[model samples]
Target: MLHRKNTKLINKLSTALFLAAITLSAPSHSKPVKNTSSPKKVVPAADLSAEDKLFVELREAAKVNDVAKTRTLGSKLESHDLSDYVLYYQIKPQIYDKGAQARVDSSADAAVEAFLKVNAGSAIADRLRNDWLLVLGKRKDWANFDREYVQFVLNDDTQVKCYAIQSRQAKGEDSKQLGHELKNILLDAQYFGEACPEAAQGIYRAGGLSKQEVAAMGRIALENNYEGLAKKFGVDDPIADTVKKARTDPAQAFREFEKKEWRTGRENTAAAWGVIGQFLAKKLDRNAIKAYRLQHEAGHHQLLSPESQEWKVRTALREGDWRLVKESIEGMSPAIRKRDPAWTYWYGRAQKELGDEALAKETFQALIEQFNFYGQLAREDLGMKIHVPKRVIPDESLVKQMSENKGFARAVRFYDMGLRFEGNREWNWELRTLSDKQLIAAAEHAKRIGLYDRAVNTADRTKAEHDFGLRYPTPFKESLSPIANSIGLDSNWAYGLIRQESRFIMAAKSSVGASGLMQVMPSTAKYVAKKIGMTNFKVSELDDMKTNLTLGSNYLNMVLQDLDGSFALASAAYNAGPSRPKLWREKLPRTVEGAIFAETIPFNETRGYVKNVLANASYYTALSSSKSPSLKQKLGMVSPKASVLSELP
Candidate 1:
């Protein structure tokens, strides 16, 4: 999977040859260079405003864990109307350093309670409440845990959810409804850690989880390489042994699995088939054909977990076995069968292949309501044109209203001063009380102010009256399009990628120091500059739209050709690196649909990136073209690269 040579060679070739050919004659354009001048230093702490000096000292005291000093400083700041935060500084170290037990003993929970009483609706108070709940949960003080848990406003923490479920179960109140909800919450959890497994075990023992469910969960854990989790589930020895054996010799493992009672008992038989499906999916065994036949013939498909059944469909898809694909999709769980567009699209395809036009059209009709990647493909299936949603024009009155709002004004000021976190906080707080119409207005205001990312983010929160233009604006079209076109690349695709990369923030800089429009790495920019023969190129030039786009497009084109014309693979290579996608491709048993390939990628970040990029590209295509685009055509198919073992070290 190492792309060390490819990375180095790309840098060199991009800088040395590509730029050399065009740098001198490159068109000049006006793109803003961010002002990097250092800010003026504050006056000495001794001479600062009383509130400011106290704030500075309190922060330092908290950092060094000087509890006495923090308390003293906190007391002095009490009159400044910041007692809650000051109290937090004095108490935070006790919780962080010494453990929550001491904090509880020291009546730290009482201080948190007082803070919450005053700042009842604040995010900080909610956080402190969550922290205290964790301490109470640790102590197994279910009384206080139950009392405080109800007040924790968001109730979004997974660990807290597990603890809450466990507390409920301890009281012998594990209702069927509650158990089902808890099961859904923890179903695909990769690691149960401590709380979740404890909760799951209680649920399992209470008859909430059937034997089949336990085995399926165990298989999933083992497949995910979370052996500790598999052990936590306490699966039968045969299932556990099969999991281990399958890692080294799957065919032999299946043979061994068949000899056990797990293979025959009604409760265990379904899970046994699932385990075999999981194993054969990885192996891409031709025996999968027979496995599918058996799965259908025995009507065991209904028992397979969605994950197991998915692999069955994927395996069938890889071998281009249409009948199995149709059967497998039909046999999936109702939720998976009805809700997942991937399966739905393939199901429709399978129906068409089986000469059932009426069913195929019915399936395609349900998918076109949402304008996503699959929607585009579904539209093609129905012979309908793919057209972009109409742009929602900015309301000048709303823009003025947003501009006049004190909170948004503060956000603008903070953003102008390069305090993005504070700016974002203020912006979000302002948004908390706004109606959907007001939100659209705010998004428009954000767009006007060059905060395209924020605009898109804010717009994304609206559930009704979607504004596609606001969500998918192409701000740097004039500069970006030419570069993409010069490289014979689709401008829409490049824009979609840039939208995802930095959300059109011209001066955006990632934590890893990837700068500007494309988030190009400093090293990448330098190598590209050198390859293109830009003798005096400065790293700061990366912040300029014109330079960054040109270099980025060149590098993208290089990787595109290197990886082949498949945008799905090339996009993955772009985000990760060339060798990673190559390694991922080599793992596939045969050429499979790109959507299937994307779903199976190991890295969660890369998988999401590939899907979003493809989806985004499809949207952009519809936005720019009068004719409907085929997302499936863009995705194409992926095959294993030819074995080049001799070339590897």
Candidate 2:
């Protein structure tokens, strides 16, 4: 059934991709109906004449979606600026504009004016509001409307524009007015996050609000391990019983999850099981949790009814009692017998340990003959070095005895199982539903193990889905190969960098003023232009893939050179400016992998940025639409977030 589902998904994905390709490449449906495709008819913003501007205003009026005004506005605007693609998209749907969408929720005139006033107010239109949507689109009034929606705005006759109006009694900070407004705002944002920003802001300022009112905030703080804040706010006082109960009893914590109390469900489970696992793992031997993990790992209970045998085995295993191993291993389903040889082997060991010699003998014989893994262990027990058994044992119970023998066959079986069935045999993290990067990696790993069928399946899945393999019209080979060849860079490495920087979404922009494919800030681009002797350049040009790649790669080459050619060093330089790597190098641990990077990489953005880029590079190489770069070599450094710099430059 599992294989069948996966196969069906594969076909569906193929069909979906085919449909998407056809739709995206097709021509417009209404070229003749009104033919709005010509470059001249759709004049750019800068090219509109006075009459055109009136036409533009009428079109804009039409776009505002005021149905009553659409006919009037559309006729007036003959050559209006329609180049503001984003605004056009937003307004088109609402436009009663005399004509556009089939249905509109409100009057276009009212909605448009509301949108314009909120988005394009003087405060928003001027340099005051740095938000791009308002500055360019005259949408400053939109933010005001948001404020109005939250009831945060002062009524025209209310005379409380700046002061807190909730508490009408007093006006000063000492007055309850400030406290009330502040608390409400703070509560809104703190409890509801994005859902209640105005209230969040109120809560932020209401420093005097009681802990009871701040329960949500306090809970968030406590969950994040903010004990100090919890204490200061007295959040524990109101729900002291719940908090104390959570700390005292973990099974109780799981009850929340069981009851579908999702807010605390995951938190409670993690905290509960974390404690349980810690208690057993630290207090017991390796064999203790073997029975437990085996259930989560190997028990063949399909995840559909997850609480079945898998849950049962897990519960039994966490006990840390080797005595229960017998019951636990035997209790697993028969299907598990196919997947979990460890269960068979361990059962035999248990029988032997219990002094069941006759049963152990039968089990060991099979372990030696049928299961090649317990070869030496089985051989040692039986005291023979003869021909191999093609397929000896039929029953899983005998396989356990073979493992107890601890021969070559046992070792080989253990080795093979470690890679596949070692963990909870459920294959939860097994290569299913993997990302493009992950699937490719899984494919390579499967290939290394000679699992050609699995590897090809994984590779084929990635091949169809990964944009690295299928993007067209831009002749990837022509545009990207040189970048790869020049710096001994892999095509995928380049692709990863490009993907992260631009998503192949050429119009992307960063808050820090970075532009286009590589997210190069205009100033930085200008600096590069000057350094590289390139003239007449603009940040807008970064939208061009060829231009962006050239500049971004050149800058990368420079950073690499600065770092004496170490990829790790170069990557760090790219993220944290060129100088931070040296400072971090010294502050970090002297081990081959400097783990102090978590502390030394001061900027969270850059630290994560470096990790993401490196991870992306590794993924890109695996995609290998043409020839992939040597990834194992490049990724030789382990636990990337651990801050390891390999010997390679």
Candidate 3:
């Protein structure tokens, strides 16, 4: 389904009006000023061709599942340029009902096959095939599923992957290899909608998985808050009851589990303790280490899922228990330890803390080349600083060629209609086979078209050629710099926050109602406006670039002051709220490195947000100034604060 956010239209219209009002209100001098700039020409909605309007309306009808309206609109667009999209929308409601295993009749199958055959090799064909594959898998139609699954390009759906495994099992394929594949896919329990849990049950019945392995899967599911999935693994009442208790009072759960003996076996017992540890760890409860210790003493640490193991390490980091951190990371599967740079960096830090200087140096040396948040930290750990890489300018001819690409044109049209999901899929689908130089050109094209998010994402895909300008484009520096500087905030830091907040999308509105370039929430915007003594500041004005930057910069400065000038804490406050970082800070036992505080933030979104914002700021600094400060320098120390002044919401 297309996710349409009407906030974009409201923002765009308000921005235009705000600019027009400013132009009209400006004082005129006696001397006539010559205007050399050509006015931007905007095509009115009425100017759109009849076919274009019908196609857009068809998309809107499909978005709300208006089957009758969609059919009516689809009929009008039968001869349109994008009739394939209309066809997809017409048949989509029949097969893709949310949460229902759609029963496909012979006619439905014939229609889908005809669509796929007609639109062969197109992105929408692959998309339709993907959707149809899920229904076939659910219906246990193995022959058709196998045929369509192979043709399904962008096989990125976890449920579809699980169903494919089940289809293999039904065909008497090797159970051992299929079981292994199923286990890897089942690791992501959060997206396991019916198909994965069923596949796991089938594997267990076939003796391809042990009881302990199934119990471990249940524990991982419970850890991800998918209690329904856990029950599907046959988790008993005792273990489920303990998990319920652990959600609110993990320490009590840990204590009770340590004393009571369950008949459900050691494996279930270990699972309970692992989950309790995860909950306790998120709350920064010291007993989290004790719960993990109980699991470790039972020799069931190996049974803990990778996510559970990572939480154990995070809890240890918060408590300053370096030995536990090192032990937990070493106990992780070699694949996981090598895959996540965060764990690798933490492992190196643990090694250094445990006095293994040579091993620590080796770990940091290898990690420094990764060029991410942790990579920057690893560089500083190795006594080096970030240096701006030589910028690779894209060929102008290649950039011009990108303008002629059909996929990009479709993506731009979807973007203009506020269908971001379809827009992003269309945009990224064409990027699969491009060379690094071509990728650079594509990113430059996205930038020129004001698709800043796509520009950043595309530029970030480059393996060798680097262009920091395209990756971190500063679109409104003239206005942003003065606003940030006037309030004594670093403009680079503001730019970094803006880049992470919205990717410079002018009409960006988050699900929680944050608006415009900086994604300022209405309440926060109003509060900042009132505090700054601005009159008649409407919530609608938050969409204007100047207003958003001003309010966001002021709120950021306020948080920075409240948090005692720590960028790490302020960034967290910006993503989450001021109260959360305050509570997080108040829980700190003593002064610690800012990186440690950021790594251990309970909310996953805010933790990554803080790291990315600070890392982005460091890169922006390197790009803008001669004296580049290290990421560590920007992350300054975070300490326990007794009181903070601001009452920011």
Best candidate per lDDT, number?
Answer: 3
Whole-model Cα lDDT of every candidate shown, in order: 0.68, 0.40, 0.78
Between candidates 1 and 3, name the one with more favorable TM-score: 3
Score residue 635 of candidate 3 by CA lDDT: 86
lDDT of 1 at 549: 93
Better of 1 and 2 by TM-score: 1
Each prediction's TM-score versus the true structure: 0.74, 0.34, 0.89
Model 2: runs farther than 4 Å from truth?
1-468, 471-476, 487-491, 535-545, 592-604, 625-649
What does the lDDT read for residue 298 in candidate 3? 62
Candidate 1: residue 135 Cα off by (Å): 3.7
Location of the lowest summed lDDT over 10 successive residues in candidate 3: 33-42
For 84-177, candidate 2 gives per-residue lDDT tens digits of 2223223343321223212223223333343334334221111112222121112223434334433322132111221223322222344344
Q: Rank the candidates by TM-score, best first.
A: 3, 1, 2
Candidates arranged by lDDT, highest first: 3, 1, 2
